[model samples]
Target chain A: MIAPLLHVTGLSKRFGGFVALNDVSLQVAPGERLGLIGPNGSGKSTLVNCMSGTLVNDRGRVQFDGRVLDGLPPHRRAYLGLARSFQLPRPFSSLSVRDNMRIPLLYTAAVRAGRQRAENEIRERTEELLRVVGLIDKADARPIDLTQVDMRKLELARAMAADPKLLIADEAMAGLSNAEVDDILGLLMRLNAQGISIILIEHIMKAVMAFSQRLVVLVSGNKIADGAPSEVIRNDHVVRAYLGQ
Target chain B: MTSATAVENPGRKVQAQIGTPMFAALATGVAVLFYVALALIGNEYLYFSGYVVLQFVVMATAWNILGGYCGYVNFGSAAFFAMGAYSTVCIYSIGTEYARSGVGKILGAIPPPVLVPLLIAFAGIIAGLVGLGMGYLTLRLRGVFFSIATLALSVVLQTLVVNWDFVGGSRGAYVIRPNEFPLLPGGFIAYLFVLMLLLVVVALTLARGIERSRLGFGFTAIRDDELAAEAAGVPTLRLKLIATTVSGALMGMAGASFPYYIGYLQPNSAFGLEYAVNAIAMPMVGGTQSWVGPLVGALLLGSFQQWATVTISSVLNLLIVGLVLIFFVIVAPNGIVGLVREWRRKRVLRKAVRP
Candidate 1:
């Protein structure tokens, strides 16, 4: 079998006396779409933070693309093609939307390519990403000026600018209209089609079911289910802990 | 292909902008003209006051590197400035000791022209290392906590200086100025002014260069949101350390000539509260967003303080600074550059709507 692109072995995290994630281990195959679902305060964001190097797991190791990622900082993880969007959109408020997009291109993508991208090239790529997210018109607008939906789009687009091998999108579709939900789902689907592995963490079950071939559920910091989405959602523990059926 | 063409068309229309080298050249020309104009005035008092004002320009610009660009407030500007001043004192004291012992004449033999530059370089390195050390210890604490830590750092450094007797400790050390400068047209004061003028040029050029570089973008990103910046692949801690080192080094270079400027270096004067206060106030009053902000702020505020000292009383100088700072904070929080930018933005918007 092919080695997993991302490997987490017996991962654990705690905050003071409270356990946030308890010995959780997971894997994502190359180019796979995995949905991560958890009830509120079930360690979904905490797990993402640990995986992205924003938070250090108390135990276990995270290996990504054949390198151990135990003590690397978030920027180093980003350099190694691991990227995530904050659950709540955290845009660089002072920068114009275009400049915001240009940041990752300047720092991550260009560094990965081992050369400074030409100014014209950076501009072209920024506009292209902005166009993909349907935010070209608001390219020069500050983050404060963007509507909620556009802000979310900007968050995802900024993550995309890193050109990551795996994109863990944390609640990228929250608080959007059905049409807007479909808009983001379509974008994610297009990205997956380009062979970028994605972990879609969302509460929108319908979108998750449609987008994810496999599913992982975290309940009170414990992974109770991980399997095909059709079978995992119907699991007794998942239904009792999360689905409430 | 058509859409690509469309995008390329507008991108190509951007006017050619002035690069850093051109900006540096223009600034150097302007600085020379200012120096010549001051010399033509033929007033030694102007050079003396001008030196103080230019010193503020350097300090304000240095403070803005960490405080304004990176959003890390440094309340210990005086500590770094004093470090530079005291480094010179230590060297002078050691040279006097060496001269008395008849061990070597190398330190005493170095002329002022060569000696001042050497002292400036030495002070910059020493203060930069301290800044790095301080940043490593304190940069993890963000917001007001980081600022308070810097204030504490100032007090600790001042205590160390007060107790170190080799450089005269609490009493102070006397640095007798030579009657004349070797190559310079003016006296020692004039020589000091010219050195400060060159330092201003270097500081401004360096600040402007950083503002336009990729590093500048990273700094602004960290300033805006450090976590987000890190996630965007910026090494936030590394960048902050760089800012601290550069800022501290520049402030140190500004203070290296202080002993010569005053001819008497006292702990109270070297670690004065005025240095810290003026460093912060000048940037805030001028606008902290760009290099121009600190330069303008320093010149305006420094000149006013000089004028007030001469025309009015020196005691009221701090009071005037305090009042002006309060007025700007209330009326124009972004400072003069920000105000100008806001005005110009409104003008452009009006024109666009009219057409």
Candidate 2:
């Protein structure tokens, strides 16, 4: 197979004596949809944080798009086209919806493109992203005005504004309705079709099974299974560790 | 795609909101008009009072850039202000020694008006460098810890000044202003007022520039949620450094002129708690959110303080600030600008419902 877009090898994280992520390794190919699922406290979020450079692993290496991200901070990682959305929508409350997108677009995408985008070009891109997420009419509104599902969509759009090579979406549809989950799933599929690799970390099994081409299961900071969604879900170990409930 | 085309260029529109050239012209005109009115009135008290208020305008504007925009509360503003005030002391001693040794021809030859701007710029640079150092050292602490470090910094600076005898130790040093007048007929105080008016214009321009620029966007992101801002690709540390340096520099510029205005400088008055408290309170009262907030807060609260100093006791000046600060914090957490925005928002909502 071709070189993976993201490669986390022998990653381990410790919170005092408790191992949050222990020797966990995973990979995602270009244009691939990978689902990362685990029980609560199973280190799914910890793994995402390590890969996104929010939390540095105690011992391991995160290689994204050919660069070792050991010493790189989150913004530097983002500049290299690694984008993430928080489990909670963390929009700049002082800024309008459009400026929220502009921060990532201006800093990450423009820096990666190595050119100064025209003022109009940024506006067009921001509006287009808003339109895609069904937030075009609320472009001028603040994040405080957004509904829960809209805030999640804004989070995704903000990440998409980075025009990343790989997107690590941490629980993008955690509390959404089934219809809203479908909305985000369709959006993620469209993003994948446009050639961006994505790691969807979700608790909802149906959404996970519907979207992931490959599924990786973690049990207590360790990867229990990694393969095709159907095969991984049916695995005896994954069933015992996670799916038995 | 068609909807995207229909949307106006938001970036260009936001830039247009600031009206850069128009703002410059209007601000310049207003400053000139203000000084002209003071000159025509020919009242020394008016100029003196106006100078103090204008100084607060600069201080408040500077403080808000870091405290309001970047969400870094600096409780050591007096340290930077004192640094600027002490810069003049340093220059004075150097010039004095040169003249005493009969080798100060170059220093004495430059007119005081020309020298004042040079001194202000030098003071600003010194304060800015200190700000950069303090930010590098303490900004990593986060929230109240950072503020505590700043307060400790003030005490450290004050102790150093108290011990240093060159600037008169704890006794205070006298700054002798030249009797000659070059730019204005009203001599030293009037000249200082004009210099301060210029500083006000500089401070306003800078604060507004940051408010509308990409830097402001990064600052707000840091303020909102620093972790998310980092993930959003904002270099938070670098932007915070810029804000602190600029804020400290302007406060220092105001302080550099303090000795000439007061004719005497001491550690207590220069590094007093009043400067720090007033600088912060003005922005909090007017609104910490934008450039206009600090201006309004300074003019209103500063003039009120000046009036109280003349009418009531000097001790009551801080009392007024404490009351106003408490009122704003409890009633309108967003300050005066917030109140105005809330009022406007309600009016719009009411109108929409009526239709």
User: Which ranges of candidate 2 are over 4 A from the true structure?
Assistant: A243-245, B1-18, B98-109
> Model 1, range B261-346, lDDT digits (tens) per residue?
99999999999988999999999999998999999999999999999998999989998899999999999999999999899989
Which runs of model 1 end up more than 4 angstroms from their true locations?
A: A243-245, B1-16, B100-104
| For model 2 chain A, the run of ten residues with the poorest summed lDDT | A115-124
RMSD of each: 3.5, 3.2
Roughly what TM-score does model 1 have, to 2 decimal places? Answer: 0.96
**Which residue window of length 10 is worst by lDDT in model 2 chain B?**
B3-12
lDDT of 1 at B223: 93
Best by TM-score: 1
Return the clash pairs for model 1, or none.
none
